[model samples]
Target: MKFTLAKPRIFFKVSRFLFPFIIVMGVLCFGTGLYTALVTSPPDYQQGDAMRIMYIHVPASWMALCVYSLLAILSLFILVWRHPLAEILAISAAPIGALFTLLSLVTGSLWGKPMWGTYWVWDARLTSVLVLLFLYVGYWALYKAYAHPAQGIRAASLLALIGAINLPIIKGSVNWWNTLHQPASITKLSTPSIHPSMLFPLGLMTAAYGFYFLLLLILRARTEFNKRKCLVQENFS
Candidate 1:
């Protein structure tokens, strides 16, 4: 059996139409989530207004891990199958994942200062998440260091694979070790532990963030593909 790359024209046209639609939807959802989180939801019984930060922080944390996991999967495809789209996706996803990781850290700190009486802690979850941010930076640096595109992709993909080891660690840190971080409120087999007033906005914000990440990834991938196509045309011309 043989496989060949799909024609770029098909991807370009589909992505061109899908990207803008996702962006519009992301904006609408995020805006509505923000309004509900900030104005409509009641204050926390324990933390009061400080708990509102969860609206942004939780989603950012989710995206940070989610995007990196995607990068690792895509990297595997790039290394094994030499998929051009996978390589482009890995590259496009790095900065966005980094942004989300950074937001997670910043917002976590903001929430922590009031709740934990400290801006930072050396807990398992926090430490692992910090390491995730460093992995993002390392991947970006490796990508930029190599002169040849293939070499750069290979190096960055290796880094992504290695960094993926941390994703599970991050997800299970609270369970694997006693940590200051709270365990899953939504993922348990039983009913969600959080109140409906807060959970609704959190859920909405998470969905919005997912859409936003998809929108960005699609736009970035299409842009890079178009650039590569142009470069190839120039070389041939």
Candidate 2:
């Protein structure tokens, strides 16, 4: 089937409208979550004020994993179907995922220093997450290394697929080993084990981050598309 510009143009037009709305909602949710986390929510009995960092740390860590997982799926789409949007999405997602991973590590360390009496630990979860960050960097590097843009996308997609093998490892690390990281709290099938007050802000923050990711992804993809267009024009000129 022949590809048409009209489809992408129509989709992007709708996305342009939706993106701003999502951004507004994300900002509002983030503001509300921050307020609740800092003031309305009671401090943890064990961790005290330090527990407040969960509002930021948990969401970042979640987004780190979530975004990489998304990249992996998009990479598979690019590899199998040669979807132009898939490659664009995967490329756009990598840097944002890296940022989230970095935030997770930093905030985790800050929260750790007070509780674990050390800033870093070679625990299963933390180590696996570190590997995830490296994977993002690796994919980004591969994408930029090749002279041909198609070759770069193909190479990066392969890296993304291979790196995804670690996702299960990251998720199961706490279960597989005696790790410093705690087991799943809110994701339990039996019950959400967190308090409602804490759960509300945590959920809000997660939603905020999701919207933020989408907003950034759209922006980056549009930038990339424009760059590619300019390069094509330059080649013809």
Candidate 3:
């Protein structure tokens, strides 16, 4: 009995301790990253002013994909283990992932106009990303639709499971077919193709975006837990 009761509380206790650390790290990374990306990093000789857009575009794109993968993993835990913490964390991730997807699409458009000469395209990389955004929205809608909240979470988990198939397609789109989007550079098996001057800020921004996601996820899950508790009390009493 004590073990069962203590399990949920244990997760939050750890989060409470980690919360301030996450915030400090997030701020430090974002501050340092933006400063380096915007002020210190040299422009790409090829794209020049337009290349700076990669600083924002790359990190957002990365986080957008990453968050969905995380959500899917959480969904797996919810389905396979019947974990309450996983469900709440999955719920917290949906909107934030959607927002990150939006940022990536918009930034990619802005960056593309200079390189691709158009704001949008049906290219495999771009289209897959659009599908990803749709998947995020689809999960959000499904998660919120049912009157029975538990039913909704289970339904959303299935969608997350199915939708994760798109992730590999998105990552491999550049290599699988001819496309305007550049092929894997920084993520290659060999040394990263990107110059160190550009790479540092990109790394920092990616770290900033990742920690920012974690901080938001922690807060949202806590708030959702409280909301569920209040809901239970109201329903019973």
lDDT per model, in order? 0.90, 0.89, 0.90
> Taking the tens digit of each residue's C-alpha lDDT, what string does model 2 give over 168-222?
9988998889998898887656787788989998988899899999999989989
Better of 1 and 3 by TM-score: 3
Cα misplacement distance, residue 67 of candidate 2 (Å): 0.7
Clashes of 3: 0
lDDT assessment of candidate 1? 0.90
RMSD of each: 1.7, 1.8, 2.0
- The residue ranges of model 1 lying beyond 4 angstroms of the native Cα positions read 1-7
C-alpha-based local distance difference test score of model 2: 0.89
**Clash count per candidate:** 0, 0, 0
The runs of at least 3 residues in candidate 2 whose Cα sits more than 4 Å from the true structure, single-residue gaps closed, are 1-7
1-237: candidate 1 lDDT, tens digit per residue: 133334456666777778778888889889999999999999999999999999999999999999999999989888898887788878899999999999999999999998999999999999999999999999999998998778998999999999899998998899889999999888677999899999999989999999988888887888888788898999899
Per-residue lDDT, model 2, residue 28, is 96
Q: Which stretches of candidate 3 lie over 4 Å from their true place?
A: 1-6
- Candidate 2 lDDT at 100 equals 99
